[model samples]
Target: MTEPAQEPPFLQDPYAPYAAMRSACPVQSKPVDSGGRPGCLVIGYAEAREALADARLSKDTAAFFDGRGSRRRLHPAVSRSMLASDPPRHTRLRKLVTRAFTTGAVAELRPFIARVTDELLERWSPGERFDFVAGLAVPLPVIVICELLGVPESDRADVRRWSAALFSAGEPDVVDSASYSMAGYMTDLITDKRLHPGDSLLDRLIAARSGDERLSEDELVSLAVLLLVAGHETTTHFLGNAVLALLQHPDALGRLRENPDEIPAALDELLRFDPPVSTATFRFSTEALTLGGVEIPAGVPVQVALGAANRDPERFPAPDLLDLDRDATSHVAFGHGIHRCVGAPLARAEGEIALRAVLHRFPGIRLAVPPERLEWRRTRLVRGLASLPVLA
Candidate 1:
């Protein structure tokens, strides 16, 4: 008898699986890793929050791999970026990058973001069907991040291809290839910026690399790749997920249409309802610890399920329902503690501008196909639609 292949748990209704896991234990043992080391998944809100900030749960993935004597190879830039470093190094890298994403810096981008939103929305014809993800959600952030990072307009297509491949969890070879290509490209970009400095963020980074507060060549290249990829990828998925949520809940959509001013304030709730990043990047346990009352052996990997924690009934009453009126500011959508996403301010600005423009221009926009028919990306870290078909 032929047996049916089962859909991946993440591709299905992930909430039910999350709830099932949470019910069993907030922190549960996961299947063994490729190196035969056991791991744990943290699903409870309190536990996840604690896990994110726990110094014992290290983010130094390169060190972890080296200690395990694993033969797997990763680009030095990819493995050594701020995203994977701990304390002293993480602090230095974060401080340098944080300068570009300050409050005033992000606010300065509002006019540019609005201009791009209007330009992108101009293509939608009345009563016409189009893939919203392709048309707006994907390109808007990509364009914005590219412009911010001084990536030439001509090279954005290749940049997007390389960035997308970096997240292909099911394909290690593709990820490695993308990492090498992106690192090489970033190295060249840094050299060009050094030769011909400009006002772009990359130029500032290059200046820092050359100045007293120095950055190694590897650090400079890695930071550029991280900013380029992280800056857009999360926002892209966030816009797609936010739009889908609004479309599914027409009442909320109508409310936003009637009161566009509320859109910005409502973004937190949208983020909490269906966060873009499903699980945070992997963190390794540096020592034996008790998380959510479960004993975690030293050196095991820990994954905090941000999506699950955001919807924890213990923290959020009526977790399943999307209530824009609710105060969702505390959601771990951007993650928590020292390693929180540095690009959140820019992402929120982009989302607010993009969402407002979409609703204003295409108030009549509706899904072209059933919600269930929409396929999600197979990546483990992010939650986003492959394509959001809509009639405008």
Candidate 2:
């Protein structure tokens, strides 16, 4: 059977059409833009990875949002961060901060993480119910990021508020205002650090180099912004989503409670079962590329289906089942190839601690409301639950 000319672009549920698109057309067309122009959406895991890591696919959305190949350059420094750029600029930025994401760096953080979780749990009352997201999950990532960057722990709340505003999916003004405020705060922090250099990632990054090569003033400021936003948001959703998964599946929770060793594997499964990132950030084609018989022209937008790819039956049998023991290496939750998430290690550590702590704090915890009443985040780009009430 031949694939249709296009799938509806507003699709939120990606399972059905994605599976069909995999065999018939790895690349399927979808109408985009205010003018209703056409572009390709890569469905298959192998094909999607190729497009994401391919040098020809630029990660910039500035041009797509504005025609004439131009952009205002949001002052928050995120637009200039590694997540949105192509090399050699991206190479330089990623290299400068790579040490912060190493395995050693994550392992060294375990003790501090344990303490963070313990303290949050201590504050909870056993018989009462509370919003775990607000009291625990939200603060966990915020505190960890602040400590990693050597930002004052006291400033985390304000910093996190600013962080959300900067990355919000809204009009240019909302984003622009948030960026300006965050930049001002970061600039002040960097200036203070320069006068009194400390043992923090940001301080070391300021001094990072490659045999005489160093990040410029602009890159330095931008890198700080990226670390702050990414440091909190991704893990924020990860912890929230993991809790939702556990409440939905009691058997999985029992297994983890019995054998905490399964936490790592379970973290991998949570990431695969319901990845925090729903799709890759916008990728613009540098040249015409065809996939599964569909053609995507230059400068057109292409979004990889991360959630769909994670659940692709071709890759994993019983794609909907949450198997903690499954080999999750193939999932595109962190994405594929060179452009994969640089913060995966830190995020993983946070997930392990978050889930283990959830079990410890809320023994026999259950959903306060029915699953049908649960409200998920409406935003299409980032997959997250709005709330998951827990009765401790």
Instruction: Give the candidate number with the greatest lDDT.
Output: 1
| Model 1 lDDT tens row, 252-285 | 9999999999998999999999999999988998
TM-score, cand. 2 vs. native: 0.89
TM-score of each: 0.96, 0.89
lDDT of 2: 0.76
Which regions of candidate 1 deviate over 4 angstroms? Answer: 1-9, 32-36, 209-212
Report the C-alpha lDDT of model 2 over 1-392, residue by residue, as the tens digit: 23223323333344665666676766767654445566667767667777777887887565455564444447737665678888777777787777788999899998998899888878767767776777777889899989999899777888887776655553556767878888888889988999999999999887766663477777778889889888888788888888888878888988998888889877878888888888677787889877545676787878887877777777788887888779987778888877788889999998898788778777788877666555555443567655656787
The deviation in Å at residue 323 for candidate 1 is 0.7
Q: Each candidate's lDDT (Cα)?
A: 0.89, 0.76
Error of 2 at 370 (Å): 1.6
Off by over 4 Å in 2: 1-26, 31-38, 60-73, 209-213
